[model samples]
Target: MRCSWLLLLPLLAACNSTPSAVNEGTVSRVADRQGRDTTTALPAPDTAATKAVSAVSDTLRVARERHNFSHAEGPSDLFRLVFRGPSILEGNAEFTITSPEGQVIFREMLTEPDLEAALVYEMKTPTATRAERETFVLRRIDRFFLPAQFHTPALDAKAGFPTDIANLERPTWDDLRKRPDAIGFEYLKGKEDRQRIAWSPLKKQVVRVQ
Candidate 1:
């Protein structure tokens, strides 16, 4: 028994003295060999990686502010990144807003005027009084309706007026004619409505005039 006890003493001491190392994230630690653990942390990120991360964060912040959407409340699919010809921004691009399920909510030619109207329409809330309440549906029509395409200029000129636009309670066709570049149309659903008209010289699509 005494001899067996003597043999186990060295093994026990070896076990107690053995060195072990642990690494986690930026830290590396060595234990036991020197009777204490030593730790080292990884170096800071390089300038390029820091800049890349900051730029991406800034882009996301700008997009959310532009759409008036919040990362905490709204879905992540609010915006679609699209690349189009320069004309698209020169009041010549067409766009469609669809529901998450692919249901068409609105479609129209994006004109400079339409952008302003849409902004006003989105920013204001309807009031109880009819006199104070303004439905920018006519101003934001491009958000909802899609125009029909045509071949020749003559046919394009004669596509008439859209029934949806004609059905509006106010703002006659003559009022719309003043803004010749405005070509988007108004829409009315159960509890929602939108109206817009703009004429774009570059637009080949025609809206039937009633």
Candidate 2:
């Protein structure tokens, strides 16, 4: 017999919140293992509840993804990342990562210009409407993070960089290679640029993996 499990985890927001931090992880859960398939998913949101929230609170209702990108050897060290914005048209977003303790570890903004740049990949209709452009940007944020975007062993098996670049890469490169099983998340810039990022316990911050 096959089994299906829906693991319900609490969201990173509380009843009331501040712009700087959240009290928990993002709201959403993936079907971790179901009949041999492990696909992350977003649960349907409550339509009425969504409408009731203030603009700042409304952002989390749009999209979220959760994963344990921890490189340490131990029990699963899960983390939550959630994106919020005023409206689909604004393209002004705040993506926050909540640590296990429900504290905001990192927060960054997705400016209007930053999101508009991706419109080159989205504009199928020439001379699109303002609403259309807004919708396109919102969809881009929704699909920003994905399961395939993370790596299991975060270091290149064998890759080279100039002396200066290598100097910057060596710390992360050496640390992850030793374990050969460290996991990290990849963030893309522009079309093909890739950056792998992971939590640095020693440094107590999120850092890039070269």
Candidate 3:
């Protein structure tokens, strides 16, 4: 009887152990499957914002490149003046000359290659009666600078008069006297005589008496 009881106890214990083992196995398999599903179900990383920023940056770069290319291909005329000197005494100057008919004849700025520089400008005039009057106008335009001022007498003297006066047609001085707009000069000065020179609508060579 004792042996029979022992055998029954062993069978009962086995029955209980079998159910626990099955439950544990089922729970472990379910947990592993759930972990795999969780990993697989995650959405892929989104790169929309990064891609958008990169696109914008690329667009800006392309626009700048186009702008640089267009500027390089644009039409342009370059005029440059270089000055070498110590301290300039006179300031820079600029001037504009207008005809009696209010036409812009000449405009220029003058700067010293070195010391005190100035701009001298002469405009086409209608005609003048007395050359002195023309000289006065020129003087006024030059701001009455003794050095920069040039009168018809000075011009005549310089050209040796009657000899080099090519376009010597007597102008309608009366009209110029009434209008005084035949020829004119303008000088721009800063503090003294240093200034930059700018010329617009530059005419062909007038006198070549260098």
Instruction: Give per-model CA RMSD.
Output: 15.7, 26.4, 22.4
TM-score (C-alpha) between model 2 and the true structure: 0.56
**With candidate 2 superimposed using the best TM-score fit, by how many Å does residue 193's alpha carbon deviate from the native?**
4.7
Residue 108, candidate 3: how far off, in angstroms?
1.8
- Listed in order, each prediction's TM-score against the native is 0.23, 0.56, 0.21
State the lDDT at 84 in candidate 1: 30
Off by over 4 Å in 2: 1-61, 71-86, 161-169, 189-193
Flag regions of model 3 displaced more than 4 Å: 1-91, 112-150, 157-210
The residue-by-residue lDDT of candidate 2 on 1-210, one tens digit each, is 122222222233442444232223333333444545343334555686554545435554345676665535544443333444556655366666666566666666656556556577656766778887777666666676778877776666665532533324556556655655666777554444556676665556766665
Question: Candidate 3 versus the native: TM-score?
Answer: 0.21
The sequence of per-residue lDDT tens digits that candidate 3 reaches over residues 1-210 is 999998899789875773453454432222364465221233456887774333222110000001110012243222112222232222333333333334443345544321122222232455434453434333433333333332222122222323343433223222222321122222234335422211211222122111
lDDT scores in order: 0.36, 0.57, 0.30
Q: Number of backbone collisions per candidate, in order?
A: 21, 2, 20
lDDT by residue for model 1 over 1-210, one digit each (tens)?
999999999999986773343323566765677679777776776786553333222111011101211111243213222223332223323454333444434344444344333343345555323322223322233333223321112123334445565433223444434443343433333233333323223332233333
- Clashing residue pairs in candidate 2 (N, C-alpha, C atoms within 3 angstroms): 12-24, 12-25
